[model samples]
Target: MKAFTDLEVWQRSRVLRNDISQLTKSFPSEEKYRLSDQIIRSSRSVGNNIAEGHGRFHYIDSSRFLITARGSLIETLDHLIVALDEKYITEEIFNKFKGDYETCLRMLNGYITYLRNQQPQKNG
Candidate 1:
């Protein structure tokens, strides 16, 4: 990939981040400092970590960042569950976002596994 933006994981994450931003707008003001803030930050971190990983030269380094990104994605999912419990979002909306997040997680895992399978050549 030429850049992190070229990665399917990053692209999907960017879309989800935007989606969460828009969805959170309907949340009550009380959540503005709590759930809303947390979900937004976690969502943004997913893409940020992917971009950072892409910038790394070593495959291992990149994979490590991707792992971190996956963690952030999971965090975002937890926030979604909380939102659902709080009635900030309906089950349908939560399910949709959950599906998207799960897809991103799987893609990231596949990419990380691919990276791990690579063997760096040593110059003789």
Candidate 2:
């Protein structure tokens, strides 16, 4: 298999990071180091963990990291929701970001399932 960098999930996550960064630009200045930073860091973590996990030698190890990445993705969505409710994002922007997050979630879940299915059978 190719490296994690070559994986679609990683690539998509990279795109998500850029999208989130752009979206956060309109956030209130007071959130410069608060909500904005948290969202950006959490979004990047999703991709970073996926890449790091791919470099690991064991399937279980990789799966664990991907799971962590998934958690980060959810956290990002929560932050997005807050931003929307606070009027930091319009309905259109919220829809756009929500779509991307849902897509990423699907991709992550698929990757996890793929990894689980690839594990070698263990002796009883």
Q: Give all candidates' CA lDDT scores.
A: 0.94, 0.94
Instruction: Give one digit per residue, the lDDT tens place, for model 1 in 23-98.
Output: 9999999999999999999999999999999999899899999999999999999999999999999999999999
Lowest lDDT sum, 10 consecutive residues, model 2, at: 1-10
TM-score of every candidate: 0.94, 0.96
lDDT of 2 by residue, 23-67 (tens): 899899999999999999999999999998998999899999999
List residue ranges in candidate 1 displaced over 4 A: 121-124
Error of 1 at 60 (Å): 0.9
Candidate 2 stretches with Cα past 4 Å from truth are none
**Model 2 score (lDDT):** 0.94
